[model samples]
Target: MAGPGVSRRRMLGWMAAAGAAGVTGASVVGTRLATAVPAAEVVTRQEIRTLTPDQRTRFFNAVKTLHDNNAANNQYNRFVLTHYNFRSQGHGVAAFLPWHRKFLRLFEAALQRIDPTVVLPYWDWTLDSQRPERSEVLSSAYFGGNGTGSNRCVTNGAFAGWQVRYPNLHCLQRQYSGGSTIGSWYSPGMIENVLNTNRQSYDQFRRAIEGSPHASVHVNIGGDMSQMYSPNDPLDWVNHAFVDLLWAEWQARNPNLANTYNGGGAASSNILAPFGVTVASTLDTRALGYTYPRWSGSSRPA
Candidate 1:
């Protein structure tokens, strides 16, 4: 909000505000926290934690509140359409990678808004690819039995690396079972050029989070049909949060990654700046910095 460098006095004022927020946030825990042990270091496992049938119902219902629609997926609807329709004349630019990132981000924010204590647990695909990557949709992995709804892996690619070929994890060979739209959520590449193509290893992750992409654990926006960015939509909040996590992970990996997402251009949607937050908004990672994360606060990133 000020100059390139904020003074220590300004920083203190912000911290003081964060401390008060922590107090108010403590009152809303799910009680389940006291009884539940944190999932064992599942980070490397990428075990897609499926929400239980009950959790699934709750999660879906919550998402509907924001989108003003029911069951975002239709029988013929596939979130993975990005890989096909972009740039009719030229080869698609990892088409799906950007759109799906945004959709999932919106999807997850809808989830957390309802349950602040909830964290969108990632389904570690590395450990459980055997269960059929298609079966790992959040609904099934977390809760079990959504019936292998969609496909995530692909049969074709330039490199065997799942990250590179699938980008955000989608391949033409991968098809959604409940009609074709199911596999659409998987993204196809380095996403934005700055994040993937133009950075040092560590900064690469942080920069990848441009504009409305990275809304949730795996939720990234894919289709970049229009350049206009509007914060009026919840997707804006969702995308930034998703990117924030990736940056957090990047920071963890390098510990010294250049912690910022400040450049803007035709390539950079830079959706985050309009909201007036920082690369590290959460003393714990809060969006819009409205409320910092606290004991039970979901706004704070883990």
Candidate 2:
């Protein structure tokens, strides 16, 4: 792995590696290099087809299309749960990330094919600091409701620690707070199977949004995009471009602290899906290599 100080040099190597061979029906999305051109030369924004006032409306429509198509194309879409049991389902556990990773890749690809250079956005919950529930961008496609509505509360399953597996599970109003490290590898001495095999997932997400000048992050609509998020919409094209950005942030801030989790703790079969695997029975994010950038001055596209 390239050290923090040498990422820029590594990125240049990636760009050269990508161009070494001939180009056919290939995608440069996951390439390690963050697509770079001098800032002044980058055409960051695509032509906004819809009026500024109708941004919400337009995004909703596009998301609706994504969900509907994903469901129609894959039989498993109906079976996939919103938050749990996904990794252990039909395919072997390892197939989980690669499968969805491929799915998300195709999903975003389709979006871009329709509109070259349109990148996947992400949800930066911090911006809505004043009112945790009511952020500026609200669409049923990904983010579920009016910030003031009933669904705003997180009220089910693990929220109520009824399950013996997750001792911390408890049902309460849906919270947009920090320390949501349950399945997240923010604990101590946990095995990180995913990060171990593939650390480049970070670089892949970084390059996918090469030309986008701002973060277009948003929430998974209908609480879980897996269920189509709507009656007619089946495939959910929900993705956060800032996933990489956040990882970088956390890595930088807490370099000494990996995602710390306790081990030997058994989780209910139900909740296993949210977290990909039971690596080391519990895994830590820092050891696995991840961080969230301070991101104070980062820009969000208009």
lDDT of each: 0.28, 0.28
Per-residue C-alpha lDDT of model 1 across residues 1-302, encoded as one tens digit per residue: 11112233432332233123221111222111111122322222011233455654454345334333222131101221221222121111221222333333333444456664344434322122223224434222232221122443332221111111111222222222233232222132323233334455432443244222232111111111111111212222233333444443444444444343323322243332112222232212222222211111112222
| Candidate 1 minimal-lDDT segment of 10 residues | 221-230
Candidate 2 is scored at a TM of 0.34
For model 2, what is the alpha-carbon lDDT of residue 38?
19
| lDDT (10s digit) by residue, model 2, range 136-180 | 333333343321235334323212211111111211122222213
Local error of candidate 2 at residue 292 (angstroms): 12
Model 2 residue 170 CA deviation in Å = 25
Q: What is the lDDT of residue 88 in candidate 2?
A: 30
Work out candidate 1's RMSD over C-alphas: 17.8
- Candidate 1 lDDT score relative to the true structure: 0.28
Model 2 residue 40 CA deviation in Å: 18
